[model samples]
Structures are given as structure tokens and as C-alpha cells.
Target: MMTILDALYLLVGIMFAATAIINLRDSLNSKRWKSAGFWGINAIIFIFGRYLPPLANRILVIVMVLLAGLGGLGRSGKPETSLEQREVRASRFGNRLFIPMLLIPLVTMLGTFAFKSLTWNGALLIPAGSSTLAPLAAGHDAGNGAGGRRKPLVWRRSRLSGLGAGGG
Candidate 1:
């Protein structure tokens, strides 16, 4: 059983995914306006639904349905020519290319794990007396108040030695 917040999160995630797919489809086909108003309303519900009294989300849903109906009736009647059909064919080819793009997320996940391991080993390989880690050692020593002096770590140049010059 999921909590209300969990359900709402799932609902919002699905709506956003659907909106992304619709927008991509519209872009490929060169459509002027992608109807993402439903997604906008879903985002609002995700943010403010908990604060409102009962039935607020349902009322919003009803309003969206009415708006969609009105928008459907407002489309201009345009006959398609062979040129438009060729454009649609090209768009379909573009849509087919979208599937291979899934490899990007897979590669990113692999790279993240590999880089995390490399960074872990790099931190472990830091030699004692290395100037690069002097500030970190000082910060650790200050935290414990080394040599019986209980002075708090001052925010001076020593505190920032390990931070490279490209601080920005």
C-alpha cells in the first residue's frame, strides 16, 4: 500500500513522462503547439493539492477535460498533400531513431559507478605530508582540538588551502 504522497508522486511522474513524449512527437512532426496543459495542471496538483480541501484535484481534472474538448473543436480543417505525407514519413524515421537513445542512460550509469570507484581509490591513495591534503588534515585536527588547545577552527587561509584557486 502506497501513501498519498507516494501516489501523487507516481501520478505526477507519469504525467510528466507522457507530456515529454507528446512534446517530442510534436517536435518531430513540426506541430505548432504541443498540448501540455494537462501536464501543467498535474504539476500544480502535485504542489498544492495537499493544502486544498477535498475534491480540488477532481475539479481540476474536470476543468482540463472541458478545455481539451473546446480545443479539439477549434482546429482548422486542412487537407494533406503528398509533400506533407513525405514530411510525416521523415518524422516517422526520426521517431524510429529515438529508441537507440536509451543507450545514453545505460552508459551514464556505468560511467558513474566507474568514476565513483576511481575517486574512492584516489582519496585513499593520498600520501601523508602531501600539501594537497594539508587543509583537510588541519580541519580534522581542528575538529578534535589537537595538542590540548581547545580553540575553534578559524576560517582563515589554512581552512581553504585544500580548495583550489578556482574557487568559483
Candidate 2:
């Protein structure tokens, strides 16, 4: 009875882990240890939270808050890119940079419909009640790849039909 949410959790865990690693490598940042700890704990929670006791999860969250309140999370004082450099990049990318942002919703809608009745080995691919949420997560995952690959026209038509069914 695995669901796409499980996969999404793994993806989130990986992202947090990467953030933790980057913070840990910030040699110039005096607070790197604390920042890395915060992100590392977050990674553990995302990956293993479902298996952890609720009380344990709460305790971990409290610890994260404490770290943040104690000034644990922060970036290195030295900017990775100067303001001028950032402006140059932004100008180069312009509106095209927003394509990924726009694709999130489109992909979410399509993925919801596509995954609604999907299954693997006789088990539902997405939990019965999470058609929208699971696909939204998948859409965010798609953002990382900068991909806006289109599903078949049949899927789009099917979704449209379903939408119409709900309207009247």
C-alpha cells in the first residue's frame, strides 16, 4: 500500500540532506555546525518521521525551534554571488526563469488525474484520498528538474471531462 507521498518524502529528505551538507561545508560561517545540525535533523525527520513516534517527532521539532531561536540557522556572511552578478544572471534569464514556477500547477493537475487511479502490483499508487496532494508534491519535484514535459492529450481531455462533471 505504498503511495507517491512516500517517494516525495524521500525527495524532501534528500533536499534537506543536501542543504545540511552545504551548510557543513561553509568553513567561513562560525555557526555552520548549528545550521547543519538543524538541516540534518530536518532531513532525518522527513525520511524517517513516519516510522518515529509522534512524541519523538514533536521533540525533534522543539529542538529545531530551539536551534533557530538560539541563532543557529544562517548563511555565510560572504555572498556566493555579488549583487551585480545576480543582476546579470537575472537579466539573462528574465521571464524564462518563471517557466518552472508556472509548470508546478500544470503538472500537479495532470499528475493528480494521471495518478488518481494508478496502481502498482495491485496496490494504489497514490493513497485514495491524496490525489491532489501527492501530485502537488510530484509537481514540486518536477521543478528541480526544470522539466515541463507534457502528458498525452488524452490525459488533458480526461481531466477536462472530470472537471466538467463536477461543475453541473
Candidate 3:
């Protein structure tokens, strides 16, 4: 059976492939052959990196470093968006601009509470209490701390905190 991590790796691989496709489109626009090759290779790594042996993975990493560090994979791309265009976009999408940002926490909140209650064949998809959630919840809690709403709580009983970051 594929574990949750396998699914996540597959999803990430898909995203990497998608990025390569997008970069390929960008390369076509700018006629940057180097950019095309770099992204194309990166896409290969993402899609196959997980399945490769440790030695091959290490070699791939070295190739990536050489391709990017010295090869300038990201250079020579023309600006697709200028400052005035960005300003116009911000004005055009006021308020809606935050929707994408808010969706992250909203998803985390819902996942934390809702997924905990999910079960398959009477066994929890994720156990009732697992540290797997701590990192995710820590980020959310840290965001709250930044707003000063959670600072007092954090200062008071950091020892009693549950999320990985420790707080009230």
C-alpha cells in the first residue's frame, strides 16, 4: 500500500513536471535554449528522482548544482510582469488578492480538525494524536504570535504547548 508520503511525493513530482512545462513555454517565448534544457532536466529529476538509487540521486543533485550554479539556468528571461502591471493587477484584484493566502491556513485549520476524525475500516487515516501535525500547526500558531494575539499565551506556559513551536 502506498503511504501518505508516497502520495505526497507523487503530487510534488507532478508539480515539478508542471513547472517544467511552464518554463518550457517561457523558454519558447524568449528563445532561451539553456533555460529549456535546465527545466527539462529538472522535470526529469522530479519525476524520477524518488525511484533512483542513492548514487544516481546524488549524481543528479551534482548535475543540478552545476547546471544552476555555473550554468545560469534562470538568467536571460525577460520580465513578464513590470512594476506598473503589478500595481494595476493589485488594484484590479483588491481583497481577492488575499484569498489565495488565506486559503492555506483555512485548509490547515479544516484538515487538522476534520482529517483527525476520518477513518478507513475503523482505523484512523492519521492517528488520533500525532506529531505529524505539529509542524503545520506550529506555522499557524506562529502567525498568531506575530499578531500579538498569542504572545501572552506563548510566554505563560510554553511548557504546556502542544504544537511543535511551543506556545499558550
- List per-prediction Cα lDDT, in the order shown: 0.43, 0.73, 0.53
Ranking by lDDT: 2, 3, 1
| lDDT by residue for model 2 (1-168), tens | 445688888877887887788678767678889989998999999999999999999999999999999888765644344457656766877787777678789999998889888988888878888888877876776664563245422233232233232100
TM-score per model over all chains:
0.29, 0.74, 0.53
Which runs of model 2 end up more than 4 angstroms from their true locations?
147-168
Better of 1 and 3 by TM-score: 3
TM-score winner:
2
lDDT of 3 by residue, 1-168 (tens): 653434544555565555455546554244345555565566666667777898887876777677677754653233344557567766876776555456557656766776666777776666556524633544444444543344433333231222122210
lDDT of 1 by residue, 1-168 (tens): 443234545555465545534433443233213345555565566656666666988897777676566652122122223556556655766655443344444444543444333423246222333323323333333333432243322322122222221110
Candidate 1 Cα outliers beyond 4 Å, as residue runs: 1-11, 14-34, 72-168
Task: Evaluate model 1: give its lDDT.
Answer: 0.43
Candidate 1 versus the native: TM-score? 0.29
